[model samples]
Target: MSKDDLKEAEALGRDLMWILGLIMHSGPEDRQRIALAYNQAQELVASIPKDNGDARPRIVACFERSDTYKAADDVACAGWLLTGMQERVNERDLPDWRKLRKIINNTVKMLTPPKPTIH
Candidate 1:
């Protein structure tokens, strides 16, 4: 979203403002999280669990050749990569970056509906 480092940082701030707003207003039933799925992909790079060898299958399982989500393969990895990156960056003593990640996770949580209470 940026033409250069400075522009990228500014653009990221602007984008974060909008994202934060959406998260606050979006109820769990909303599909708004899908819009930011690509950005969320950064999580995966750090999320390759030591026991989960060959993660491709897990990634591939989410993609489907369908009319509604033809681009799922590309966007589905956002959350995974974002989470992975967050872990790695935090390990490097970056508290501020971790704050941004908390916001992202909150957004995801907001997009998820509360489990039904068995009546």
Candidate 2:
């Protein structure tokens, strides 16, 4: 990624962290603010370039997965994921494209709730 791209990604990561923090601490009464921040974070995530390899996909996947539930745990998971993304960007050593995609696909299995079984 170019220097500008890196900077932008870093900024987005920071923004996401802040938004997630807000969501975690705010109560249900703040639903409107939470929703707005969530959408803004989604837009920020989408603005990240695909050329960044694992960075974008990993963030996107984790963010999407987090959106699956209204629970605090999922929000915390997203915060953790964003922290890792920021670290990778700061280190300038994102995972390879192929590996990151594989990881993202596998995350669905790991994070998804078990399907109900009908007798």
Candidate 3:
């Protein structure tokens, strides 16, 4: 991929991260905002160039089953996209990218519901 393609992917990753944050904080009663953010993220992912190997297709698949709001999956997909972008930019060790990846990991953890106790 070209430099411009990497940049565009990075921008989309950042935007999707923000939208995922919004979705995390939104309540079931706030379906409108959640739906909007979901759609926006989907569009952003779709806008990513197809030359980035299979990352774009994989990320897009994360949003295909729309019945449930899988925040953890969505956040993980965004992180995966960013990871691909970082690799393409050849800056995996950059402090900024590290920090972003950390945040994405934490967000995914927080969004994941606890497992049943099986008492």
Top of the candidates by TM-score: 1
Ten-residue region with minimum lDDT total, candidate 1: 59-68
Q: Give candidate 3 regions above 4 Å deviation.
A: 1-6, 28-56, 63-96, 113-119
Using TM-score as the measure, what is the rank order of every candidate, best first? 1, 3, 2
Give the better candidate number (2 or 3) by TM-score: 3
TM, every model: 0.38, 0.32, 0.36
C-alpha lDDT (0 to 100) for residue 59 of candidate 3: 50
Residue 88, model 2: lDDT of 44
TM-score of 3: 0.36
- Pitting candidate 1 against candidate 3, the one with the higher lDDT is 3
Selected candidate, larger TM-score, 1 vs 2? 1
List residue ranges in candidate 2 displaced over 4 A. Answer: 36-119
The whole-model C-alpha lDDT of candidate 2 against the native structure comes to 0.47
Q: lDDT tens string, model 2, 1-119?
A: 56866565555545554545555565654534334444545466666665545565645554564555336544444433443344344434543434443443343233333579999
Residues 13-110 of candidate 3 have per-residue lDDT tens digits of 67647646654675644434344444455466566755546444535444443323444544333333433343333334333555556555554454
| Candidate-wise lDDT, in order | 0.43, 0.47, 0.47
